[model samples]
Target: MHELIAAPFLEDFLLLRPGHASGVKIRGHHYLELRSLAAEEGPLPGWLCRAAHRRWGLDLDAHGSTREVVLVREPSPYGHGRASYEVNNGCNWACPHCVYGDKRHEGLPWPQRAKLLHTLRDAGVVWLELGGGECTIDPHFADTYAYAHDLGMMVEILTNGSTLDRPQLLGLFTGRRPYRITLSVYGATETTFDGFTQRRGAYRKFRRGLAAAREAGLPLSLSVVVTEANAHEAPAMRALAERYADRVREYTHMSPTFTGGSDPLAQQAPDYLHHRTPFTGCDAGHTSLNVNPFGLATVCKISRDHPIPLLREGVAGLTRLGGIADQALRRHSGCTDCALQQSCTTCMPLVTLYRKAGAPLDRYCQHA
Candidate 1:
């Protein structure tokens, strides 16, 4: 006989076989195990154990819960099972380097959005990132965040930190301690920050927002989008973030200019285009799925305009996304045989999107 803890939230991420195991959570830690193990059944499949280790770093044989393993190593419990949804695509700040400007936001209705949350929970999604041009600016932001948390998904918010301290929003973080927020820092000083944002006194508002989040004891993190203007102060910005945030991440690779037109602020560094890494594979539809506010689930945030809707289809549609990715790979036969296959940062869906958009693919083409 094998004993398992009862944790309903982990059912999808853990892949526990029905009738074979049970779930329970104690002190925020989920414990799980097989209901019965016969001598003839042998040990658990090696693939299952390996996947758990790779994605979550949990040792199923150890009998200890993921809570113990993850808390010691990371600040949040967002162990690999992540999916990002753009609650809305409208941003308060017109940052020159923004990536999703071309994709318009239609706004997912509250009823549809609520249903999608339950569908995601059913699909075994544990980590849900609420993002957009800015998640806070969305009218349904509070309701959506509350719904995600209520469904037992570990919620993460990606924002510019300009609205973190609103008194009305304080009630959202009342229950959980592991909730996370990612604040993008433009520069270390008020002058540079305001200049990058192109808004007078924007820096002051940002500082106030960061202070509000810290005071609320939210699990705050900072990210600096490296650009020609702010690259010099990257270190200083990081140090500044360390003062208030629990963690900091850096985005050095600048995004391609959005499809519509040229924005001087959104232009990427020339060097950024040349620095390539091996195109291993993408986790877009397989491990992670990006959903637009219109309730359409595409391969990734960059390819959000694609018509593949996973909201209505639920988790069953993931198989379709996988097939789409496979077809994309087949379309790019040269990628497989290329000498720079190991160093190619471009992926199949991205190549397809660029081709469809009639955009210049040779820019990422190392041969050129």
Candidate 2:
């Protein structure tokens, strides 16, 4: 049965209309090699894989699509780890759709931030995401970049690109791709940008900032958060993406599981959740640690309750959280039925967005 199910799925994926971009077997398994598939394509492969597994218990996509490079470190005690630090959680643009919104703006003082990086470096963190509402808003953005560089950690910043126009931003990546600057382009027009962020005339600043970052010879990754308002504008956005090939990553809105209120926080049913393509086993609880300025730690960024304190501790301590590393959070449910599940980032934070307690593998992930 396994062989029969897998054979057809492979054939179907291979026969996908535009044919395939690249195909080369690394070892024993076969992968339908391709460059990139949109969110719609994510679930198809995973759902078919699960059906094959259920019929005969075979995992077809054991070998994921090959990437241009590898970012994770080996010999990691926890089996996986994602590195990050709190540079500052304030932003220049006020995108109403932001999950963190004003909450992230309230951050730790300069002294605490100074110690935070040293602690992360001591733990052997390689890639540190300088995430926030926006890291570029800090007056010491360049210094922060230098600090991360000095610690021998590759830095990545999540920003709206309003400040990248500053010449100093280039110095960080002059000779090499020192850092990754992700510019979130909510809308191509000033009206849309201003409307979403509640700030007028933001499009101009973002465009200039992106040009500055590109001019600086820095690596740029565009993160587009698609919502109801901008769904129709996808084609234009895609054309915009074509301007910057292989550097853009668009994330469709994963049902609003957090308190990020756009315009007004209309009371929605807690059970009213939305599903995308594949169900991913988000090991953030096991793979990464997200700490706010207050020192409260949770598995993912949307956590609002049952928080663990990791201000003084490190990534290794995330496993020792009160409710983490439990059987409930060991896995999630419904993912096995997903077709694009293989490409999904199926983290619990992505699924359990309504604010739940304990990290049990059974809560959101349950393998069929």
Question: Candidate 2 residues 224-289, lDDT tens each?
Answer: 656555555656766675575357777663334255333322222223224545543445545555
lDDT by residue for model 1 (172-268), tens: 6644433578889999998889988878788898999888877877778899767887877878988998888657777766544435333433345
Which 10 successive residues of model 2 have the least lDDT summed?
1-10
Return the top candidate by lDDT: 1
The lDDT per prediction is 0.62, 0.51
Off by over 4 Å in 1: 1-80, 102-105, 257-266, 270-276, 329-336, 351-363
RMSD (CA, Å), candidate 1 to true, equals 9.0
